[model samples]
Target chain A: MLNVLWPIFIIISIIYAILSGNIENVNKSIFDSVDNAVKFSINLLGMTCLWSGLMEIAVNTNIIRFLNKVLKPIMKKLFPDLEPENKASKDITMNIIANILGLGNAATPLGLKAIEELQKENNHKETLSDNMIMLILLNTASLQIIPTTVLSLRNSLQSDNPTEIIFPVWVATICAALAGITITKILIKKGM
Target chain B: MKIINYVSIVSMPILIFIILMNGVKERKNVFDIFLKGAVEGIEIVFKILPTLVGLFFAIGFLRNSGILDFIINIISPIINIFHVPKEIIPLALIRPISGSASLAIATDIMQQNGVDSFVGKLASVIMGSTETTIYTIAVYSSCVKIKNIRFVLFAALIADIVGMISAIIICNIIFV
Candidate 1:
């Protein structure tokens, strides 16, 4: 949990910095990181708002319903407890679609929307539901078809073949997603 | 490559166009609906802002304190047992922590090793295959105010380990 990991990260880094005599860099990084975080959030804000707006249109026009139908089999299998008519199903489908298209920024807003919907059905409200944990796992082990950022970075670095690693990326990502889902399923089944 | 680039570029615009057209055909007040959702987006961002600031600060301290290199030195011998490249150990470690930090490390790797080198290809595959696990989980869980994430973190990290190891093996078979 973040409650435990956050402090450990800071404590370990501070002690390491002191021993290495790199305390100044750590001090500078604190401020620099805050600044960077704000800038990053602002950048995220625009894209998120844009996607959220577009999502509204998609929902109002039944585009989400169409997408949900297309993704029904997969969603049903992954979230068997939920009804096909659930709002969370639509949000999850849109998030997965955006992710598959490599729309990283767009996917975050939709993913948050899906989590919000899932929270509505959560009885405990504090602890994550099984489906919520599965959603997070899916995001962490992201199944992106094209890694736009990596390809662009490689192109900028003047690689002879900018997209040469796409196939390998697919292989690794599929393996990751499968592994995460399998472990989560087992843990949930064992009442973890 | 060109076709992939083109699809990636046009996909968003095309999606947007389709959504907007659908809204019009449905006779909805498109602008009003958009504003409503955008407002919700603002609230979501505000809720997660503090989490982002804290997570970034911790990641920054970790990355700048020279600890990752120390950790890498300690783990390289163990990692060598699997025949994985030592140069990418830092990347596999950092990939799940911070996106920007991993990007920096990946760029550094490709620059030093040449973009077409075996190490470079492995780094690229790793970058594409993994996500910033802590950040994504923190933002989502915090936004919905979930206190206990349970086994999600454990399972996700397992996924990252599998992904990174697979990247190394796949790169060896395909690139080398």
Candidate 2:
């Protein structure tokens, strides 16, 4: 997917920049984007290391097992084919937990780890499995409970009631998640 | 707001404490295990560095080139037929593409529309509900070296569209 989309973005951007006489901005954006990407990754490293370490502890201590037990009912619905003891299940559970808590920084590392674990079980090395696609959909739907960053941004902008959108956010997120799961299931059944 | 603040602040520390305590109870060499995991984390980050650079470069061009505004302008008339606020078009379009881009647009919406206004609240809901679909998919798939993500992008985009429409409808009913 990114294979085609990435080049299209650059091509369209160049054409548009040329038409609008903003080629210089596009040139600067190229260099700046690379620099920003590195800086952003560096910013992520600290939290990623911390959560990765903590998750390791959780795994070693059977805490993940406890969590898996706790989340089993819901997990079963989302991942019926997955075995209870699979390492991917543990990583997926932790990723979902981090996302729900609005710890996006933590979620990325955990999610990457989840993908790595899922890859180990994949029969086709290049093609994504149903489970993998579902996991990505779950992340994209983003069922965050608090949306702390949005609230903070609103607060900084001096909103009179910064947290008032929480209910609406929850409603939208649940709908998105359901829609994602339903569509993916339909497509998978149709052999897409 | 205060309750939200309190929860966000306390959740992290409490979670960390619980995990460490559990490790101790299990008689694990916590520091050694942590070091091992951190090393893996570093490797994962390194693996993703190229993907981020590529994705972000595309996003930067698409953002700074005024293409988003152009697209928004083209769509605004059609979207206005549905009574969706014009200000949210940029946000809804950008939300699934780039997190930072959407954040900037959302902040701009709130600044211009008043943070307590209908458009501002709707933007907030949209931001909270949707993820950076392209960025997340790229990073995760690339890390695993998965080239074919059949229907994953399609389904994720549907979710994003549903989330944005839900935000608009829910806000209309509640805010009105």
Give the CA lDDT, 0 to 100, for residue B45 in model 1: 79
Tens-digit lDDT string for candidate 2 (B71-119): 8899999999999999999898888888877898899999999999999
Report every candidate's CA lDDT.
Answer: 0.89, 0.88
lDDT of candidate 1 at residue A92, scale 0 to 100? 84
List the lowest-lDDT window of 10 residues for candidate 1 chain A.
A101-110
Off by over 4 Å in 2: none
Model 2, TM vs. native: 0.96
Candidate 1 Cα deviation (angstroms), residue A6: 1.0
The true-versus-predicted C-alpha distance at residue B81 of model 2, in Å, is 1.0
For each candidate, give the interface RMSD after superposing the true interface residues on Cα: 1.4, 1.4
Which candidate wins on lDDT? Answer: 1
TM-score of chain B of each: 0.93, 0.93
